[model samples]
Target chain A: MIKLKEALVIAEAALKMARIRQLNPMSVAVLDARGCLVAFQMEDGSSLLREDIAKAKGLSALALGMGTRALVGRAKHHPAFFVGLSALSKGNMIPVPGGVLIRSPLDAAIVGAVGVSGDLPDHDEACAIAGIEATTYSWDAGADPS
Target chain B: MIKLKEALVIAEAALKMARIRQLNPMSVAVLDARGCLVAFQMEDGSSLLREDIAKAKGLSALALGMGTRALVGRAKHHPAFFVGLSALSKGNMIPVPGGVLIRSPLDAAIVGAVGVSGDLPDHDEACAIAGIEATTYSWDAGADPS
Candidate 1:
């Protein structure tokens, strides 16, 4: 499992990079293996809903054991099951981009995930990837380094 | 309902106590009466499971109209029904200690609940109780304190 301090630093770095890149102010959340939040932060100008969106995205990634972007494809193919998942998690599971699974650098084990929100879907995803890369962990994109 | 700022302060204090006492790192959650998260934090070394455990416990307390510890006795007598609730809430119902409802100090209306995990069950409960006491909100034991 990733340390909480590491998780927070990873999340903060993601937000800072978003600012430097001129992306919309964003909120980020990191969740541990069991879908528990490790750390979370919302930039001052982010939307009120950013926190919930970030958390749900991260929870979906953790619970499903894949990046949430992958779930988006699956969700489109199996809309009914996807909708069912939302109800099953009491409205906490969000199948969308911007949630990326983090793998250990040494052994490639699943450590946790990071979720970003408050920008376009692609932009949000970029921020999440950037955040994971800032840490020792790597983003699990099923083979894509970027 | 408890405001978001109050909820954050309560969760932080609970976590600070966990650190000062040299207990296991803990994750804490505060939810509104409608079961939406208001604020959350996890200590530096808490496990990944702590996040889910804390949120489920808080949601259980909010939905059941009592503390999670009280629900434990009921769960024992109605194991089947209790298990069914997990399906009903999409696995968000955890009938365990460390989930406590918060009531408004003046009107005694339900405000929210706090959930803590990453320590002994009784110790987790103590941290949760300490958090609520730190706030203006009072712990609701299903009685009229007003």
Candidate 2:
């Protein structure tokens, strides 16, 4: 279970990384394995939709048991399935790169997921990874390092 | 318009109030007038559904143009209408006392709403009001002072 303290730590670290990178204002959401929000923060300048997008990315990762980065290609190849999935989830599944799966470091057991939005998708994913790295947990963005 | 900074202030103050009062761990959600989330936080031990309940309370206030305290009576009298409204909102509207309408101090215009959950309904409502009081804005729980 992802404790609320750990979730807040991940969210704070992600926002701090965004600031260091001088990225656009961002919103970050952390969700436990059940796709329930644990901690969420939206920067002052974030657009209204950023909150929903951030949470949706996290939900997508949790629902699919894979980082949203992997879903991008699958979504492109199977548009109907993706669309139906989004509707079924009440628009909570967004297939994008910023959603990352959190895993227990010792056994690689899935714990939760984090999602970030506002910057480019890749940059958002990087921030999410940076946030998870600050903790003892591990993160998967679903793409082998190239 | 409610800034993210203000939203966080409301959430943090609400949680702090809950702790000071020795109430149960709580979840807080702040939503702009359009019913979009601005900030949210769930205490470490909060149940998974707390986040949804908190946000739904705020959405209920925003959608009905009144604090949820007022809606409770109306809902009891008009169960079918309340039920339909909840379905129309896709389960976001929850008529209960923990939801409070936030008003701009200057003009009394509704700026947003705040919701708190995890304790007795009256205690939850009190925390929401306390959080709003910490800001320059005003709050309405839909009941006149006795």
Candidate 3:
């Protein structure tokens, strides 16, 4: 199924892209519904802090149903409410970019998501999209990295 | 002009670039000095756990004038304090890669920050570098990513 292994593929692709573009380095990860690490990948020279980013963003993508970046705007309109969410999420709720929902394009059903950084917010989001886009496996049927 | 927006763009570019190159995906967050939302991004399928990685890493990066990733290394060697910090931050003070200070090139100052995830400690650091390079952004003069 579309489990942790799929997360690994996304990470591998992200890291490779980072190097080719010479955009510093990178760190990546995948998580399950409970926000636990399922699949993870980190480029050389990336820092340990990145691990947290990957986990947090990945979770955000799934929880928010929107990219982490989108949350920033919504949080602004409702400061108090956003803060409450931040607390409720145990500091895991981030309204930032670099995170997107992973779903079955065919049916548009939510499946998983990816989070990225090591670049700018937009850059992180872009990479995340790319990571999810190039997957040859089928989330509906569960598959391995292609 | 290239303040928060610049930072976000740089981070996103780095993430996408990294992913395309088969590197690691990353989680990145950008914030203003007052901890306002500047920009944010997360890769796709990043799992649902790392939702708040950006906020935690941003705090560390802004708090210190170095790199959050560095703190993770330190934490490994000194779990006692990290434990306390973790409790103090309530899981918001995540010390990991892809987290760094943002500053002005004209004058080294703690203006903003960027956090990343998805790779190993070293790799996260590299991705942070890519973000900085691609965007005319730099770490806070004395800010630490941790």
User: Which candidate wins on lDDT?
Assistant: 2
Quality class of the docking in candidate 2, CAPRI style: medium
Q: In terms of TM-score, which candidate is strongest? A: 2
Q: Which candidate number maximizes DockQ? A: 2
Residue range A13-62, candidate 2, lDDT tens digits: 99999999999999999988877888888887677789889998988888
Better of 1 and 3 by TM-score: 1
- 1 or 2, greater by TM-score: 2
What fraction of the reference interface contacts is present in each model, in order?
A: 0.40, 0.65, 0.02
- Candidate 1, which segments miss by more than 4 Å at Cα? A10-27, A33-36, A41-56, A59-97, A100-111, A126-146, B44-48, B76-87, B141-146
Cα shift from native, residue B68, model 2 (Å): 1.0
Cα lDDT of model 1 by residue, A54-103, tens digit: 98888788877888777767777888998899999887778768888889
Q: Docking category for candidate 3?
A: incorrect
Candidate 3 share of real interface contacts: 0.02
Model 3 CA RMSD to the hidden true structure, in angstroms: 18.2
lDDT of 2 by residue, B53-77 (tens): 9988888888878888888778888
Model 3, range B1-146, lDDT digits (tens) per residue? 23756876767765865676566556766766655557777787675654477667776665434567666656665343344335335765676666667667877555666666666655665666677777665653122333
Q: After superposition, how far is residue B139 of candidate 2 from its true place, in Å?
A: 1.5
**Candidate 1 lDDT tens digits, B30-50:** 877777666678987666577
Q: Is candidate 1 or candidate 2 better by DockQ?
A: 2
Give the C-alpha miss distance for residue A94 in model 3, angstroms: 1.6
Q: Evaluated on chain B only, what are the TM-scores of all the candidate structures, in order?
A: 0.92, 0.94, 0.79
lDDT of 2: 0.88
